[model samples]
Target chain A: MSLDKSVVNVSFLEVKVWRGKDDGELVSYQVPGRENQTVLDVVSEIQRSHEPSLAYRYACRVGVCGSCAMTVNGMPKWTCRTHVKKVMDDGVLTIEPLRNLPRIKDLVCDLSPFIDTWQQAGAPFCGTKTRHEAPANIDPESKARKAADAGLQCINCAVCYSACDVVSWNKDYIGPAGLNRAWTLVNDARHGERQSTFDKAFGSGGCGSCHSQGNCTRHCPIGLSPSESIAGLKKSALFGLPKV
Target chain B: MERSLFLTQRLTAMALGPLVLVHLGLILFAVKGGLTAEEILLRTQGSVGWALFYGAFVVMASIHGPIGLRNVLREWTDLTTGLINFVTAGFGFLLLFVGIRAVLAVTQTATQISG
Candidate 1:
């Protein structure tokens, strides 16, 4: 976590970083190698000593915040949790912004498109009950509740979004994360807009667009299976919605 | 609607799975038995079972093929949804017409056969 340049290093790691917006090239820098260093640590070191203008994002420096997600060596991952030794190839590291979103700068992408798709899929939960009423008793062990719980822990990191090929090919298709969010809401007993949510999920560029390639599931840092969530949505369409 | 199309595609696919296996098995049986074209025609001729089986196959295939084509065209091309639907519907009708004619030609009795 320390960027202090006074500490001498016995070995150096060649790190290639994307330097600009969409038209940028990978600029190389020799970073001091350290044991137990994360990819975020390397990027921070490069910014501290080599290029002051290099732009990227990170917070909490731990796995909790999903902001540090980027394409490392051709795979979408949470750079904060990814160690340098595990991802580097031939003593080299390549870092770039997450794909399927507009690049704002070097490694910072505009997350508006990702957020907008979530809204389009009716991901925002609509509450049917107010504070005055007692909370709805949902059995956690129920099939619908279990299905909902399976996808409820999404961090909205867009790692799955970046890994998805459907998003790259079909501009209108709401990607896996959004569909996953919709699925959780669909299974909820208290959501007032279940029908609308179903309509939105099955509409144009909805769950039907997913090819079930499992890229979203495979690349997810939180281990959530958006592919499974999407399949559940399709299954709901086949057999009517599960009775909550 | 997309939901209807999705459901239809899946249901037809389920139907097609067994139909295709039976069709392929029939092909192998005929080839192994060294049955000539005339011999195959004679067996199929005037048989309502063969007629109904092939009729169902053609109908399911006609419905199934274009729906899949619609999905592929929507994903891989710049065509409008309306245009894609139109094209796929036309393809389905074409398949039905040609498939029905072939089924009739094979299954019709000798007395019913015409030029």
Candidate 2:
């Protein structure tokens, strides 16, 4: 039997992508939009066909990499998972590099500041696991694991950074994603860096700075709740810990 | 001071949510019945009930607004928090004095308003 041919017609989609370095402008490019076309597909198509000068960054073309996040239609989204039908309006799409970060080139943002904030927020998993590390059994339903699971899905995408009004207002604020990351490490069983992490996470312009506008949670691609993590941090901050 | 003030602000806000609804309902009922400002004033001008209601309102509001303003000053201005707290506390007392004066003008005994 011959293949049951059902060829889906690909159409040229007009995507208005932000171009240039920090001092950039919005430039238009048309790309092939297939049946299940993602935002990254259009960008890559632009690079392949129309504009060789267009610069953007992405490694794995799936949601796993988390490298391809941008502001789509006035909202932050993981471009790899964001389909054309979800964001395209009247055949016009406005794509911008993520906000609250420096733009290195067209559609590609420098994540150094975002990653640095994670470090500053004390998000590293410092192990208390020694050279004589034994197989430590953790109950799946344990309080720490349950708490950590909610926040551990962060792909370090700066979509939360772009969505955070607090970060926009107070540049010193570590923001939702960073704070969420810190929350995960706080629940980590083997992390030796918990106390120091808690200290930095509770300081001025840290968790206290978040007004819980629900932006980070609202715009998150994976249904993660940064707002809840921030609330948890605030509750922890109000404890018997000595204040400076 | 910060913690206590924050707690008071939340408490007052909880109080005001209902008070505001009641105030709005009163206004709406009066407007619906075609009651003039003069007629409303005549009812409230000497009533102890009106005075007590307004007195409680003034106290709660005076407690809340200044604390909220202190945070606003700290966030928006170059003012030191100590300075902000001092200025806001002074303003709260000023609001209390004026509010109390108004309440006394309407709610106190005949001799109190006249004197």
Candidate 3:
């Protein structure tokens, strides 16, 4: 026999993607695939070629926007950042909407709770500067700025919330992304609302409840580690504060 | 209940942090050095320090594992009642017994080791 052998070039996918209106049925999808294809690519292919009825959301194809995050193969992930070969072994893929939220329709989980929880996490940047005044200068190398920068890249994907086991169990718990956001705001030097943000994220179903299981870090497609951020928060709560 | 649990978990974790790391480091060093069991016992025999260290490790582990398992059962499994506590307590006692026996053997002098 010759030492050289030919390789197979085929595009086939068997995706068990959830389908229907709210409170709907699970449906299977079989679509064409290619090497280096993403889960979002598959959904888009299905929408464009096979079934025009599929619904999903995405603003940027890259991981930067965090808009195209979805549950791929049982883990919440940014679909845009995920490759088919990495997740879809055995030619099988199961696509589901993000968990711990209302499902608006097939493949689209409602993001209203995520936003609401962001507020619950106290993530808004509140400064005294008015619209007419010159912008206050913030030092990039400052400790506060670096701490804030640690969590500022989050795109509000809800991937952390969906990937969080704590959020699923304790519904009151503001998930990792929200807590991570709160941490950044807490670290903002311009923000006078630091104490309030701390108060919001420190109690029951809060930063203390995290078991440091690191599921959020494991699943984050953007490489932001919310577990570290949460740990930082816990440290502040426990030891860094001056005695009251 | 919350305060006690948090305190206990923290205390155990604090104790375990160094103990587990030291334990792992010792296992690695011993196995890599190809040290025999007799050589290992030679150092440990009649050593109160080793007994205390191992005793603290076992006690901390007994406190840590059941609390962790308790949370897991509460979250993942539906088993709850006095029975869960009874089982957890029983497990802790078993760990204490086995752990103490190992510590005692290591603490015994050379004559006691062979005896």
Best by DockQ: 1
Can you tell me which runs of candidate 3 are displaced by over 4 Å?
A1-9, A21-25, A131-134, A240-244, B1-115
Off-target runs (Cα >4 Å) in candidate 2 are A1-9, A126-129, A133-139, A188-199, A235-244, B1-63, B70-115
Ordering by DockQ: 1, 2, 3
Question: Model 1 scores what on Cα lDDT?
Answer: 0.92
TM-score attained by model 3:
0.66
Per-residue lDDT for A1-244 in model 1, tens only? 8776644755899999998998999999999888788999999999998899899999988788788999999999899999999999999899999999999999999999999999999988889889999999999999999999999888888999999999998989999999999999889998989888888999899998899999999999989999999999999877757678
Cα lDDT tens digits, model 3, A142-228, are 877787798878888888889888888867677898889878887776787888887777744567678788999888777889998
Candidate achieving higher TM-score, 1 or 3:
1
Worst 10 residues of 1 chain A by lDDT: A1-10
Candidate that would win on lDDT: 1
Q: What is the interface RMSD of candidate 3, in Å?
A: 4.0
Error of 1 at A200 (Å): 1.2
How close is every model to the real structure, measured as TM-score?
0.96, 0.73, 0.66
lDDT of 3 by residue, B13-111 (tens): 988999999999989988876879797887788888898899899889988887666556554655664666677778888888888898888778978
Give interface RMSD, per candidate: 0.9, 4.5, 4.0
Spell out the clash pairs found in candidate 3.
none
Q: Which residue runs of candidate 1 sit more than 4 Å off their true CA positions? A: A1-9
